[model samples]
Target: MDEMAHKYAHILVAVDGSDGAEVALNKAIESVKHSQGATLDILRVLDLNSLEYGGAGIALDGERIYKIEQANEDYMLKLKERLLKDNEIEHDALRVHLRFGNPKIVILDFQKEYQNDLIIVGSTGKNFIERLVVGSVASYIIRNANCDVLMARTAVNKSK
Candidate 1:
């Protein structure tokens, strides 16, 4: 790959609150900052189905459910703020989106919707092992997505 050529025009970055996601996001921002032609879209998919059946024994209070939804939204906003404020990634070059569904589908749909030049996703997400046993979201995206993809090793999260 010609890393120096900088051919990508529009980049779609998929973040799943993983530490690896931070790396992917940073990489995308750096690409946009360098390539005047590139614009970055940050996508966070909340797998509502996973949340519902994720085996968290604690029964959800109705307000808690709403809070979880709100938290997801807040996380997206914070991603924008972190990029714009901390990294100085240009506002004009950035956009943030939140989707509720299967991450693999959401990513592909976003790629089609935005016609992204490239997609940057973490190799390991919240459901990495599950992905391994069945299939990884990243793998699914790579197999089905039309655009180029960048898959990092592991996310850098507080848990790790």
Candidate 2:
């Protein structure tokens, strides 16, 4: 492989506050480290459609929903800070994008808008098990994304 050709100029890493997702983010950061011109775009998608109104005899309030959204944003912000604080990578080139929608759609839309060179995501174990189930976002993105996708497995890729 040509070291220069494999350089990722623009990368998008999707995280959902999962340990597996953090591993993927670390992999994306590693790629940016190799390509000095590369830029890292970290995204956290908030799925409002899945928000329950009344479930299991429980009620949710508007204030609670707002708080949830705020918490998600704050989490992403903290992640951005941690990535930037690392001296090995250029902090000025890192960006964080927070969106509310289906994660699959949001990711694909951002890929198209930014023309991202690569998309990195954490692979769920459901793909290997026939009886087990997995969330739809990872499946949808893996099947639909036009650009190259890297599905990081927890054992192989550890968070930095």
Mind sharing the TM-score for model 1? Answer: 0.81
RMSD of 1: 3.9
Model 1, 5: alpha-carbon shift in Å?
5.5
Q: Which tens-of-lDDT digit does each residue in 27-93 have in candidate 1?
A: 7887788776678999988875567544777566679668877998898888788778877566888
* Candidate 2 per-residue lDDT over residues 31-115, each given as its tens digit: 8877868898998888766667666545556798789888888887887888778747777778898888888789999999989
- Which portions of model 1 miss their true places by more than 4 Å? 1-5, 52-65, 125-129, 154-160
Clashing pairs in 2: none
